[model samples]
Target: MSLNSLASTIEGAQLVLRCKNLNDSINFLTTRLGFKVRMIMPSEAPTIAVLSAHGCTVRLEMVPNATPDAAHLRLLCKPALLPAGTPPRLSGPDGMVVDLVDAHAPVHVPPAVQEFVLTRLAGPESWGVGRAGMLYRDLIPSRLNGRFVASHILLPQGGPVPDYVHYHRVRFQVIFCKAGWVRLVYEDQGDPFVLQAGDCVLQPPEIRHRVLESSGGAEVVEIGCPAIHETHGDPGMHLPTGAWLPERSYDSQKFVRHVAAATPWGPSRLPGFEARDTGISAATEGLGGVRVLRPATGPANAAVESEALGAPGAHQGEFLFLFVLAGQCELGSTVLGQHALHAGDSCVLPAGADYRVSPAPGLELLEVTLPARLPA
Candidate 1:
């Protein structure tokens, strides 16, 4: 048959192997081979089992006289797509040989462009209708080559929103309440809670959540990785109905909520600024960090010492941004020549560029960086 004809007739291909012991083979495939058990035949003393990994499926049939030479399996995938530490070859319980080959496709990466971003007060023209008919403004239009997306969302009409329970498949994301207040609920987080100005939440990947209501004019700043991600609706599940699981993890990430009022300012790397950690670092497993920063009181011109402000250094990650929340400041970096930042003004600093900020008294800013852990 022609290749096209054969492809048309096949839904999927599964390798069939004979195993001396079914249970041992199943255990080896799942525990060592990293395959998920899809099905097992016969409730007790099963002779057949199915397993899958990386979209490839296989069936193991138990037989008294099984041999490794019975079948040969070869799988191909991009080297970058394989899980870290995965070996190139693996032997199953019945001496089955599996060869893993690299397809060597170029990784999908955002384009490289000189970083430059400036957003003014979002006017009617800047606002666009988004999910649930809400208004949104692109805060970082370039989004660091599509590695991240920062948006300003506003609920114009507000109250009893018809938002559905949904979750995103993002590497990292955080929402900060910028104005007014919003009510929201999350899976396993008991009851709906209101998020006021300055409050922020780290919504871990795949954690179902819903926006219940908001006061008119309520605004929020949201940042997420990859700029684009899937938002899947969970019609079968509802939020705020289960016991709170503060320590529970979803996809290796934990949810975090930081109330500005309850969080205390701590010493910052910069002498003149105090910072409030938004608990995003812990939730993202070193993928990101969020900090609310403001000039420490008692210093009118508390300039960060030039000697202390190390030479411009570039980050090794995808994104770094600073948003002025209040007052004014002068920021200098290798990527952004010394520039003044006012309330609502922001800048994206390219990775590997050393930067420094000089704040006027009472200046407040929001800073975010990917890969929470920075190299010294």
Candidate 2:
């Protein structure tokens, strides 16, 4: 797969820790708190440990050795790190090397506080390999034509992530809770929405909100129209102002109390979303606490004639995810080399990927499009 062509871009001013012995260091970090492994790259040789993590979706990656390929792995790993031997002051690609060095100089956050933070954040559904903090994960952003910004996020159970929201810009937020649940407090609306496991919530931009609290934390995969950072406004936005739903919410409290609580909301179950057109090989569909969409039929052959020079009529500039939930697909591409993608596999189409799918029944996918940046 093409690394640069992959969807998603990194965010700004986030934490990214890099080290030589990634596996062991990650193990230590996760054990301490506020970090969990989400995705891990496939490795056969015992010496190689190429992995990434979401420091709240700020990408962090590592390579076990300083081999040539590991260099590519290292560069690719740090969308943030700077060139080597360039004076520690000039470390990150961004102008923050000096700042990072200054921060690292003082390990001010006490170990107790770090552990406390870890207890509050939630875990993701697909915790790829590794234990806790050192788990493998990737942050694949969906940036179409270098304009629209779509980011994937993973929030680990942790300490206090104070309740707050951003006011600098507007955005349309679609959040999917794959595993665990969180309590959402909308300052404007007043009442907190107890989004349970498998539930989805759509919040309009500039809506003041934050996670009042969480139980077992929660794994939230959020896709938004236009991504703008969410920050707390002035002190005016605080608790007691937003209604906190303590009882209706189903969390560890429910099981602890022995109440028969059920999910209160879920994703849209559009009919055409799961159905394959024709000559398709396989398909899968699910709604409720989790959503999965996959192709039922195999890949379709390109007519290879008159339409070769132009874009498809109906869908233009739209991105698609060919997700393999069960089997594999023989992915052919002019740029990316040929490979077989198995279940839990995903590929992104920028302007779009032109490839024929092999007849496999269990490849599921979800197609998401951001609202036009400027009005259509």
Candidate 3:
């Protein structure tokens, strides 16, 4: 009944174009557009040519009188590929216009339009299908004006993930597991490892990895700089390259896997809570850091038993993200009124925005900040 309902049954897309001169059109598509011919009409003189390139297939039909749209093809590539003194727009012999543009461009982080944001799961609509059939719930819907993105991703029907070896072009990115477990493999990481609840991994830029499998209902929180970026596939590259290089650099950054089970609770800057450092600070050279904070209670918090834990430290940096992992807490600020957050809730406070967080006996949250250590 709706277009969304038809989405599952759809297979692929093919572009059909009528051309007055099929020979010239084929040559233009092949040479100018970088498309390769896949099929032809007859052995002697072909009237049609089926071409495929860049994940798209097109069929150029031979028609004596055909008035096609002005935009027959918009090729995204380096402008230098065109002849000297030629403009970006070109008219081929078939009367079709081709627009040339840049495809492999550098990452762009738009100017920050910062604002205080609070998000919670609304209903089933809050979840959308993403790559590898994972369900993604947008944590930062505003995307901080395209400067950053935080997503709550999950796999309801977890098993062998259909994901391939891939890498992203980003300035900063990390994944924190919130529930269940996921087995993943990374380049030169020795072997596949499982990431359990309350754990995290720092995915340096251009680090090739693959999602081998996951437990049912597995979920994670993903944060990255620059809301828009590219995910390039590395199908030919194999993981666990048999070399174990813990100090290897992936674009000036090292991969980190922080296991929660082995981490001990220690004094945190925020009062009334102890924190378990994820070691991301030292690994990233203070570019970013993560801490799992929980209110001090029982014998498990001996490390912070003697330390003075105060009210939530005023976040003093470029960014601050807080996600309620368990129990409940109230976030209040002089600018914004008080709001209670429960499990699965997330909030972001702008720079220099003084805020106070409510602490309960069972309260626990994950805090991520840029510049790992804030200035005093």
Candidate 4:
């Protein structure tokens, strides 16, 4: 049969092993381990046997001088498989080792290694191809020692993306549309919608979603906690589920779509700039807050035209990141010194770090912080 025809009839997989004595290997697998006999070939001689255990299937073939594969097989199952005070390890008759691990281990969050990092737009060396063929520039090369991650991603040759219905195993995540637009769909979140430039969304943990397509040259800013996380694909899930449960919780965090045009811009909590709130803080329940910082426009922002984000100490969170969306700005940090940042430049500040932002003409900066609110 042709490859396509054969692929159509494909099913699960079974590991193959060579054994010197098929009966001894079968007895050891069935008696000591929790495997059940499935098939025995050539009933009279019984030189081949197939056994199944815990969703895994194995085939044993008797060979006078067979040597087992040196591969290590690790299985996630109940710890009760081994006796008390015994390690979850065993050796098969073929000399292969099996390791049992707890299936429901608690989530691991790496400790934060606080530091100051700066990425310049001129650094073309940082941009590389990432998932779904999108170009990604690592804003935080260190990832703060894997405690956090921020990226400037772009879809240069945009259109129908290869992304599918999936979800992230993340403590927190947010994506901002920096330029162009992209169509997206989330589980039980109404219909497929377009994420226009300047709009942002909070993708709480395990919220199944997909990126259907994007306009040409679309750019986005993606940030997540713990830096390294898992993206699980659900091929069975269909986008737009046709269910509009806006308040649904994905493990205690709600999904939020902050539209730039609809959101009202107001005076910033800081002295010299106006703020456009993304409403992420309330959605994540103090997990974090995201907003756009622009030069103060009206009376509320008239008094001080110097400090845009804050003077030195206004909002202090465990993590803080800033991306220059447009124009230029001067960032002065007490501990890290001063630097001039232009469009496409990004910066990361340690928790409780003293810093100030001075916006130049038409400066539009994106700010993100953890723990959501500021101590007024």
Candidate 5:
């Protein structure tokens, strides 16, 4: 068996150190190093004490013969989280060495209110192919003040795409195939699979993947948090190269591949509209959800109510948007008065905004929102 086959997921790591005086060591870590005491062995003359600071945890054990040349604790922390001009190394009461290393800062703040905006494709002349033979049209540029971006990607002459194995450092992201098909291979996903129209995949952050091939005129819609993120190439790793482990996790999230044809249409927030869940909710652990919504066919306006036609209701999230796949509709809110939507139209609904959508019969919408679990 390989080493990876025997390895289990590690939740966290805590360093153990020997200290001659636990009380003095705790005082130095708390007062000098800005660490907080999480626990202590005893109220009087404690032998062990747990200290935490800047994402680092340490267990200090009182030892009678402890010396300064004992094991050292190396901590990785964001530079901004630590005090300015903090020394790289520090000594505790028993000569315990603690090394602090600079790491990338992780900070996120959602918008207070959602921004109502819209975009429409001009014409074929505007669909110009760019890098990697992919034509991308940004959908939500002003939404969440550019914290999130939804784009329409198309490959006019798709085949073996000019791409490389890579991964993205993002909070949340997903790709839904709108037209044609594309083949993709992700690390630990077994083999390359083709994503047909109506299929979607929730790509967890930092998961290595690659776009292998695509049919001509293939189109897809990709939504991601923070609007911008880095896509780093993995020259050392190759897809379908590792053991097949679908249950394997990347940054506390699992990869999800949802097929619209396999998923049944369920009830949606709007009356008379049915939704097809994309499994992104469970994948993100309530971080976000994607759904294909369509109005139930029968009467043109049987379930439409004048009072609730445009009544706005607020939602709790960092991002929310809709991409129209077919038919037309009118979305309205207190902030953004009635706006017409048609095929290929994309709209961004800001956070905590009251909004309503009145769709015409046969209207199809691809909806995405952050924090899959939201207040009704």
Candidate 6:
């Protein structure tokens, strides 16, 4: 729990959509939206299509199967909880499909449009393997802080997670359960911590924490600071290192205690950790700083009358990365392609760019910030 290394922020999401016909979907995306398509899978049984248009961190996939009767489309649309009606409201009869757009450098999404996406995306059926049934909603990017942010992760039904850990080059993460329950097993500790919806844990840099995947599945919303690299140094060195701790047994309390003592959540909190009730404000936190905003204040709001986030028209920081972690927001400019960002969508801020963020009814956003460069 001690403030481990900085986590990675989510930059963007890979949206998988389905259509009555794969060829039609691909043609619409490429001809109308300016996206180029590639064949990830080729076979008459399950025709496959991939879209890796410019500026997209992930690709969009389209799979066709005559038997599933909308299984392929449902796979993509349901994850985001898209509406049940075929031909989503966004696109025409076939539904207007969009590729990835450069949300500045970070990511951003409007509230109203976000709900439109999630409404059709959510549900028990949308979750997938190793995915825990979670649909990424907001991908907030912070240039000042040098990482992106994400929230609203859903775990699918049917079982607990296998004992595994995540080691990423660009992402430092914190996973929180919004619904259901599960246990956390660390490599150094013998016992496991039970976490339910609303409870969150910070995985130290390179620290490997295991999720006891449940049979009924679980939903965990996670925040990651993408682009936060790990460093290696001699033992006892305080440099940022992301090494996974070897898994051990609970009976070995001595080893657990030893590691616990060295972490921020040690003696005081078991996992040296911190939480902030004020809510996430900027695009990045200063090096070695941790911010845990509560669910009440409601994510980050830019155009609040108080100018809570920033002046209505003020553009002060180096850059701003915005995303709709929960709910929705209404802001400047009409987002191209995907309409607006839902809980998992993200947008980047041009360096030193100025913009306003206003949350929609029930909408909340988490934005992180960092300086252009560290002081010498």
Per-residue CA lDDT of model 1 for 1-376, tens digit only, reads 2435322423344577888988788779878989865544332125666677887888787889876664545555554545557667656666676666553322233664547576766459888766655777888776667677787788998688867777776778899888899999999988889999999999998798999999999988888776755555566686777779989898788889889999999876556677899888888788788998887777534655222224434555556677887788887766567788887777776655666778887688887877775543
TM-score of each: 0.68, 0.40, 0.74, 0.76, 0.69, 0.39
- Output the better candidate (1/5) by lDDT: 5
**lDDT of all the models against the reference?**
0.73, 0.35, 0.77, 0.77, 0.74, 0.37
lDDT of 1: 0.73
User: Candidate 6: where are CA atoms >4 Å away?
Assistant: 1-153, 165-171, 187-190, 214-217, 223-285, 288-325, 333-346, 371-376
Q: Which ten residues in a row have the lowest lDDT in candidate 5?
A: 1-10
Q: Show model 5 residue runs off by greater than 4 Å.
A: 1-103, 107-113, 124-131, 298-312
Error of 4 at 6 (Å): 35
Better of 1 and 3 by TM-score: 3
Candidate 5 collision pairs = 114-350, 114-351, 115-350, 287-371, 288-372, 313-354
Q: Considering summed lDDT, which 10 consecutive residues are worst modelled in model 1?
A: 305-314
lDDT of 4 at 61: 74
Report the lDDT tens digits of candidate 6 across residue range 188-211: 444565665444454544443456
TM-score of 5: 0.69
**TM-score of candidate 6 to 2 decimals:** 0.39
The worst-scoring run of ten residues by lDDT in candidate 4 lies at 301-310
lDDT of each residue in 1-376, candidate 2, tens digit only: 2334321221223344545666665566557654544333221112222222343422244545533221111122232343333333224343334222321121121111000000111246434432222233322332322222332333455544433443212233345554565676654444655666545554443444556655554555544323223222333456436454423222111101101134222222222224322110111111011234343222332111111224321123333333343455565555444666664345554443334344345444333432121011
Error of 4 at 301 (Å): 6.4
Q: Model 3 compared with the native: what TM-score?
A: 0.74
Reference-based lDDT, residue 277, model 6: 20
Which runs of model 4 end up more than 4 angstroms from their true locations?
A: 1-69, 78-83, 93-95, 298-311, 314-316, 374-376
lDDT of 3 by residue, 1-376 (tens): 3434333323433466889988789779878999866555321234666677898978677888888664466555554444556566657775667555555556777886658999986788898766656888888888888787888888898789976787878888999999999999999878999999999999998888889999999999998887766665565688978878899988778999999999999977765677999998888889988999997775453222212124233555667788988888778776777888999999988765667776656778999888787542
Leading candidate by TM-score:
4
Q: How far in Å is the alpha carbon of 338 misplaced in model 6? A: 14
